[model samples]
Target: MTPPAIPPPGVFGHNRSLVTPHYAMMPPAGILPSRLPGFAETVVRFQAAPALGARFAQALLEIGAGGGTTAPRDDGLEHFFYVLDGAVDVTVGGQAQRLGPGGYAFVPPGIAWGLRAEAPAQVAWVKRPYEPLPGVAPPVPRFGNRADVPRDTTNRPGRYIQFLLGTGDLAFDFEMNLMGFEPGSHFPCIETHIMEHGLLMVEGQGNYLLGRDWHEVWTGDFIWMGPFVPQQFYCTGWGPAAYLLYKNVNRDVT
Candidate 1:
């Protein structure tokens, strides 16, 4: 849908310097507190589940007060979750861990695991079975919070952005990073690469050109694009629009 143009942050004119057009590429969509017994808000996009592209599958696990999910067995898919708010207890790969806001965990395929909310927690998760190659077994589950890691920015000239690596112990074909876009900033060109995307807005509003359509999105919205869709965005807010973005990295070409 073509979103309405929200006036730039605050008043116009001389005070304009204080006001800025806010914009951001968000993390996931429909990530809200849940009414279910064991889940809260959640937004899980296709980019995070590359193996389950547009499938009639349940990619997100939302929990509310006293909410949670039973220990599910391998459905031939990998499992990953990042906490956004509150906390939740996760049991994966025979290990139990309590994840608070900013915490994260990943369960490899074939390993049994379950999840439950502590109070009210928001988590973004993905389900895609590990692609097992000959002589290789699935890796162990991983757990941690944002504070447990460091922010790594891609030192591209003229771009100011910060991100964090998962455990940095294993190599992932894709990277999910918290992206930032300041007022009046932009991703210069329509990125048309082999990588697909699931951009979720965590904060701010902006204009995004996806394929041939210009879409305006705000916090809580999501955009999924197929490979080579030629998409770009412009930030029009005072504060930078920050969102957890997912995209394949170090991918192979045909």
Candidate 2:
């Protein structure tokens, strides 16, 4: 196990809430499942308000057939949703769209959106406060099914990545991406960077280096990596492994 790195300075606030341990790993056991109004059979793994010491919230939402959110209400936050399995009907700003596997949608801050599934489905949602930039408003909601999102090979042809968001000016401050690695593929030696991360294992299993220890992460596991923390991941199972990851981007150095 490698030692943890010093977190970056100037966290979103000088508030004490951001200072927890260097890393967090939430297995299925840590999920205190809940059923809130408008949400049926959903388990929010990390709230980011406390547990993981992050500026965003993420959850593994399991929706039963004919169950979904009730109404659209803006919560002053930006959101990203990706479907891992089954099907869903996501309505963003009054437009209803049907999504199967690899479906994704992004709702900018203050935008109304809702979700429901026809069959049992596993959907991952990541949310964070809309970080406003002077003179620029957040982009309108972007929705699409990523089944065709081309996978660009990483250093190795077998390690591939697909970004659900557009490029250049259209790119939002945060990103949700899907990464796939063939069996035996490995991550970079170690990464210590400014962008923080929230990752959900979507397929297969791998050993991931988070904070000061390496954890064998399988499908359904969740990880939170604070800024400047060392991170790495590798696929060891006979089949390819994949995960949906979130990271804050295009922000100030602080």
Candidate 3:
């Protein structure tokens, strides 16, 4: 479904941003509240700090056909784009690729990447600056469709996960991956982590622990977390619950 264009942020552009002292909940009331430059035929779920108390930002962006970014973009932040519906063409680092649902592209910091919507498309836009490691080599651009990637459900029998970039050699300061839970399944314990998160629900429904509250979340919902915010999930809907997760990694305590 092609999403309707949203009003751009006002000249003052202050109200769209907010600071959730503890946590925030955005149920599927079908409202996307924030908008800024660098997009077209798109609506944003939310953006960076003061609103969510996080250093990084993630937005649920929907682009209509023939609508996309204004130019090849490179903002010196590592970025990832995961397609949720329709199709898109991305050209980056001398490589151009077309992605349908479940396709993803990773462009490392400073690489030129451009996007065009062939069909109306919804995407998860995740961004954060790289925390450089002195000895590790710089990362490279990678493009792939998740259908071709392994879910590797062996060790994790009933559940499924296709790790897009959580591994030994990826050399990134953050991790972005896909996770699924069978209906009625849940985490055994609450988890507290130093890495903050930006989670976008792609499918199903569930109750999630955020800070001190449990909020109902379903497809099209986005959740942000600051450091050590208590978190966990329980799937209660008719089908599996799945989400694309973004979390900072490979960094140290200040």
Candidate 4:
């Protein structure tokens, strides 16, 4: 009889999770799962929060079929939800819409909102306190999908960007965007800016420069960049790389 084949080890000797004063690189493999108060049958991995030096909170959620919020919730905080896979029904201010992959919705502060998974689903959730600007009215609830947004390729070859939320209006204090890059493409220069960011890698792989270190990141990874921390990205692999980015905008420095 042939000897029994050995199975591979289940545990690795090391992990890739990294944290710094300026940024954090959290791969899905190293994330600790948790539950949220209003959600059921879901796994939540919070990537950025005030405890991590970020003004907003970002979480990646995996919901089982038939699982979601127990009831509508309103915490006086604005929210943005983007579906990464499967199907979900999101309700904002008593209006409900079924969202599939790449679908997204934004709920303004003080409005009631909730979600229910029609199938097993993955989603990115962002929450932040509304920053009021004098003479500017607060933004209203909006919903759309990535397919509906036009990609702007005028910046350069192999690079494209989509502003999911209109940036021309001052009433909007934050922005969510989709950025894509072909293999071997990269940012024109290292960026150091006032706006902090919560970025979720949605597709392909890349080398991301955070502060002074370059880290290999792939799909399902999440990065948090604090204000003025230098950052840049260089795409790798055979296909394209893309990320969903959240940044505070249209507000004066306090």
lDDT of each: 0.59, 0.77, 0.76, 0.91
What's the TM for model 4?
0.93
| Candidate with best TM-score | 4
- Report residue 201 deviation for candidate 2 (angstroms): 0.8
Evaluate residue 142 in candidate 2 and report its C-alpha lDDT on the 0 to 100 scale. Answer: 81
Give the TM-score comparing model 1 with the true structure, all chains together.
0.70
Separate clash counts for every candidate: 27, 0, 1, 0
lDDT of 3 at 3: 96
Candidate 4 per-residue lDDT over residues 46-121, each given as its tens digit: 8999999999999989999888894645579999999999999999988999999999999999989889996799
Ten residues in a row with the worst lDDT in model 3? 10-19
Better of 1 and 4 by lDDT: 4
| Overall local distance difference test of candidate 3 | 0.76
**Positional deviation of 154 in candidate 3, in angstroms?**
5.2
Tens digits of per-residue lDDT for model 1, 1-254? 99978666433341211101121222342233334332334322332333434221223455667777764444766666777778889888779899887787777667777788757666776554344444544466778776666555455322344334453333454456766677787776777876656666667877778666667667766666656777877887667676666665553455
Q: Please identify which of the two predictions, 1 or 3, would achieve the higher lDDT against the true structure.
A: 3
Please state the error at residue 95 of candidate 2 in Å: 1.4
> Please, what are the lDDT tens digits per residue for candidate 2 over residues 1-254?
98887656534343222224766776655467676665665544443444557888887788888877857345888888888889988888778788888888888887789898878987888888877888887888888877778887847556988788854453378878888999888766788988888888888999888766677888877778888998888898889999888878887765
RMSD of each: 8.4, 9.3, 6.8, 2.7
Q: Taking the tens digit of each residue's C-alpha lDDT, what string does model 3 give over 1-254?
A: 98977765532453322237645555434444565577676666654454567787777677877877746345788789899998888877779898989999998888888778967888777877777777887688988887887886766645787778756564787877788889987766799978777777888989898877677787877777778889989898889998888877776677
Candidate 3 wrongly placed segments (more than 4 Å): 1-19, 28-40, 47-51, 70-73, 154-157
Candidate 4: which pairs clash?
none
- Those runs of model 1 whose alpha carbons end farther than 4 Å from true positions after fitting are 1-60, 134-137, 154-171, 249-254
